[model samples]
Target chain A: MAGKQLFIVTGATGGFGSAILRQINLLYGEDAVIIACGRNKPKLDDVTKGFAAGVKHISVDFAERQGLKERCQAIFDLAAGETFSAAYLYNNHGLASDVTRLAQDFDDSAEIEDYFFLNLTSFQVLTAVFLKNFSGVPHTCVNISSKCAVVAFPSMSLYCTGKAARLMLYKCLAAENPEVKVLNYSPGLMLTTMTENFHNTVAVDSTKKTFQAFKEGNLYVDTDESAKKMLGIVKEGSFTSGEQIDFHDC
Target chain B: MAGKQLFIVTGATGGFGSAILRQINLLYGEDAVIIACGRNKPKLDDVTKGFAAGVKHISVDFAERQGLKERCQAIFDLAAGETFSAAYLYNNHGLASDVTRLAQDFDDSAEIEDYFFLNLTSFQVLTAVFLKNFSGVPHTCVNISSKCAVVAFPSMSLYCTGKAARLMLYKCLAAENPEVKVLNYSPGLMLTTMTENFHNTVAVDSTKKTFQAFKEGNLYVDTDESAKKMLGIVKEGSFTSGEQIDFHDC
Candidate 1:
């Protein structure tokens, strides 16, 4: 039990993050140490309580740029100086639906800047911190992207831009840093809090119907199914370090 | 002559924007007014002076969020209640060459955010401003993207992410706004200021050699040739709105 692998999952309070954590616990047994990170401590505790004592919860707001590296370093230090066999740095934190609405309403540059900072900057900071501190070979950084990253949907401009930038960032990091296994996971349209608003506000009936189909599993995926597929891909590990692994295929 | 069409060209001092301005002047005669926009007022003046009195220069930093929409609205107002027939919003403005170095040395979140704002948000703002105000049909918005938008490159994360976002933004806008002509131009591997920096700093001697060959017309494209081909494409207007036009075929 002492020598088992360690996994780090960000946004652990979210639907996708919780699903992934559940899958890992189920597959890897109670020996595996799962570091569940989220901004909400109560939510984190609730999520991790069911899991074995091996699960440790860490809470840190990535948007607070002051001493982010130091905070990440402290997290690494608490891990008993053990380098992970594989680290899953899931940068899954995202904005509420109203932010997308704000981005769509204004052509103002300042508002756009704020959106970029919130959605895009946090991903960059977390990635850099993980890469610098985590000395794990064949380390996996699974960036949670969306269908918005590939196909652009109306009224989700802020979400679309941020997700798209993260996709490109992963690609760049893959090309630059060949050692780290970088995967862009497009967990195709789920019924998360993010999608609920998307369902409510989309003007076109066809678009809403399509999102409904996706949510109802008539289209493709949910958090649990997507997480299972993603875990399968991680276990397979046949892909190159910087390859984009779409969960739908698995 | 008084009723001739109006066009707005952002980053009007640089390579692609300047060339596009020159070609438009040649095609539309002295009646066509080109509103040259950039942060560099002196350079804008120098670039537009040789053209007919129809050319007007405006200095505005699109990166600044405060009052950007108003400032852009003023530019449109200068057309004397005449909306643009087409707006070539080419923001060829880039950051310092030490961007990758800074991202690596310092924290990249803020800098990456800035890059996204400059490259992606500026385009969005300009497009929104022009589309909302202008009533003309067949109104064109040509976004100058790079090869990096499609293919990931090392040490150019900012450029790559920003360009990718720009490309997708145009795609989304094209899908949503069928009335507006949105074109994504991937001027593949041009001998631009951005490329020159990559050749100098990076250890990739082969890339530098290839760039040199390109400049010497040994590889594939020179600036003039690329510009001429792009101008022909723009003039033909054969491409569907939101079509991604790569220079490799041109």
Candidate 2:
């Protein structure tokens, strides 16, 4: 019998995260073992309830720095001794910056450290553990990057910095490991809770105007649609591994 | 008489930092109050001693998270009650990554956190405090950025990520504040202590080969030459605000 595919998705309860999960189930059906990770147990359970493939929910708060490595290892332990044809890690977890504040307003070291620990450090550690644990498996790593990764947005310094770091991290990963398939996918402007907060709290006039246009013009990409496109790109696997492929571009 | 030109340079003991200090002295002479910051007391003293400009040394360790804001404030406090026609901050302090490690090798959360605390968080906080403390002054913020900020190099993930984040932070700062001048300058591959370490310890062959070529060909940039070009760009102020001007681009 052919081996089952392994799929690990973080932020599995968020809008794009859940959409990616649903699409994974649809695409792979019973041929995959899907490990869904999120902080809220109830939400995670809801997200993984009806998948055709085997689903395992792992509750994790990325903000909690202690025991993070062990937690990441435990994620791989879920499929211990089970052989897989391929393994995929969807690094979709991230947080939005405080849109009310500009870069100059972030003077507190502790606050800035906390923000990076959750967004950049945790993200890197998780990907590292995943790659180490699945060293022998054919691996595909996807970073849910954003337009902010390449461009600056007023009042979104933290978010843009995090995304840019994440994108560069994946690019380095791709360059170092030729056998690994790495994709930095900017899902475009999706209408999620994060965007809602950005629209409401963004202090800069120019940024607020862009969000307003996105809202009024209904230009926000549907989460499921964007997720599907990302998966399609993944399935095709023709992209240059380190290159960033955005939703609008493809 | 017109006010003095206030110049603040961090990592003042390092190759590029010292070059910048010398250039400022050459350009502004006694018209500049040059604040030189570094961790080593003797090195700071050596760098600032005998400069044509009025020089002040502030010993600071960016890695120490405690009392960071106060230290940043102390930087601006050195020029208290003194007027200036223009203010310039050369944010040159940064550490190169452990080149023996790849992106996947950075799984330890605490270790990763420590790296960013020194590189990104401290960088942002210093810039923030500088902007806030010198709000009324005509401020120019220079991020001593690198080619790694825009491209990923194997075995240099942490350094690349930090540079990328810093670049994005400055870009956001420029976007949010039109009145404040921000420059991300990529001083090309300079013969410095950091490059020496990179050459000796880099694990990736392709990256190591590039460093080898630079060494054998004597292609490394002179720190003073690059610093002068950067200062020339700053003096001209013709480049678009927030634009990344590379040493080679000019």
Candidate 3:
């Protein structure tokens, strides 16, 4: 058996997931296998190619509940039936949108429901699947929550509610299953594709200007730095099973 | 202006809501206007009949976002036009269900979405509407959370997640709006209609047995006792604005 660790990263094509996968490969050498997962196959492939040869790509639309159980089972089967030494079930995938615009012009329930599905329900289904399949002790589940989870910002009601709900879900699950090391991580104010899109689409010029000011220096951190900090936390195992860790401190 | 205080109670037909409303009416007298809000108008009327003529009934479907907002606005308009003294906004509405069973047996996402709407989104929307519209200063927002909000319970995932999310929402809102006194309260286990239904329909005997033990003096407090304790806390006003008060302590 290979002594190297296996990491399953969801939203691998996304900013934080991509950065974390790259950093893990850099740190652990070529022996690490990264099961990079996302709904978009082409993007997943594009992101995985830069990684070492052992890094494999998997495409699964977790939002679609149909056949999700079987699909996850297949992934577990493909992992050679070996329990992962460590897994970063990073729920980095989310709907990037301008909440101010939505708040102004579109307060539709359907739109809110769509964001909730992508951001919250998918996380719930994935957590249930992983908890059932992986009984490995010392397993870590790292959820990528936003600052919105802690504070309610105006205009981003959908994103705020979804992220907040997901954080609570993980907290409850972590409390229930004390054996699993569940971390509710707030990757504070990363100037990634998501935040860039949010900035571009912001309706108010003042709000946009404020975001730009923050993006220039104080409010943003690169994905690589976030990933390094998070991985360091995991390595140290300093947190209790259900503790929340923010990126600013990480 | 009447010397009595005004109270707004959501889910007024529910056990805890009714109990709290009764206690408030007894303490404050017939001049107090208790706005009983719920979908079941007839039940609310029946419950509040003997209490006071000042009691008003507002039939509201909590899951209907637009309808809820409109109803809340109407209530605020009525209260403002009357120039009531102090106001207490008690968020007592919620739905508790066996989430594991629902997830396994039910395929309808609409059902799950409706559950969240009633239990989570309604709290957010209602609180926002009340805070925005009501001019009553030194206003109190009392949120009735659950023990499951703090501790994870099997089969009650929906309730757990909803209450937990709302608790955090109240916390966030309290932090932002320091002028408003927000109370996140857990009434502990109560022998409500919801619990009775839970005991009746639970698939597992162990769950039913545990609930029976809880119901028969093991894990629950009397609704009247819990309400009295909560009212005492409200009267004292010793707790900080963002503090959470669990009635189990009383």
For model 2, the stretches where C-alpha displacement exceeds 4 angstroms are: none
After superposing candidate 1 on the true structure, give the runs of residues whose Cα lies further than 4 Å from its correct spot. Answer: A65-67, A71-75, A96-104, A215-220, B83-88, B96-106, B136-138, B203-217
Q: Compared with the true structure, what per-residue lDDT tens digits does model 1 show for residues B142-227?
A: 77777877776666666778878887777777766676667788766655565676767753344355566766875645665666
Candidate 1 global lDDT:
0.69
Residue range with the least summed lDDT across 10 consecutive positions in model 2 chain B: B39-48
DockQ, per model, reads 0.53, 0.92, 0.20
Q: What's the TM-score of every candidate structure?
A: 0.90, 0.98, 0.77
Task: Name the DockQ score for candidate 2.
Answer: 0.92
Instruction: Give the fraction of true interface contacts kept by model 2.
Output: 0.95
Instruction: Please give, for residues B1-250, the per-residue lDDT of candidate 2 as tens digits.
Output: 3699899999998899999998888887899899889878787677767887999889888999899999889998998888888899999998888989999999999999989998899999999889876557789999999999999899999999999999999999999889999999999999999999999999999999999999999999999999999999999998788989899999
Candidate 3 per-residue lDDT over residues A1-250, each given as its tens digit: 3345667777788788888877777776566666777667787667666666377677777666456556655554556665445555666666764445423233244455566666776666666665555455345787888787766554454566576677767776665565777788887777778788878776555557768888776768888988888877776778876567888875
Q: Which candidate is the best by lDDT?
A: 2
Query: Is model 1 an incorrect, acceptable, medium or high docking prediction?
Result: medium
The candidate with the higher TM-score, 1 or 2, is 2
- The collision pairs in model 1 are none
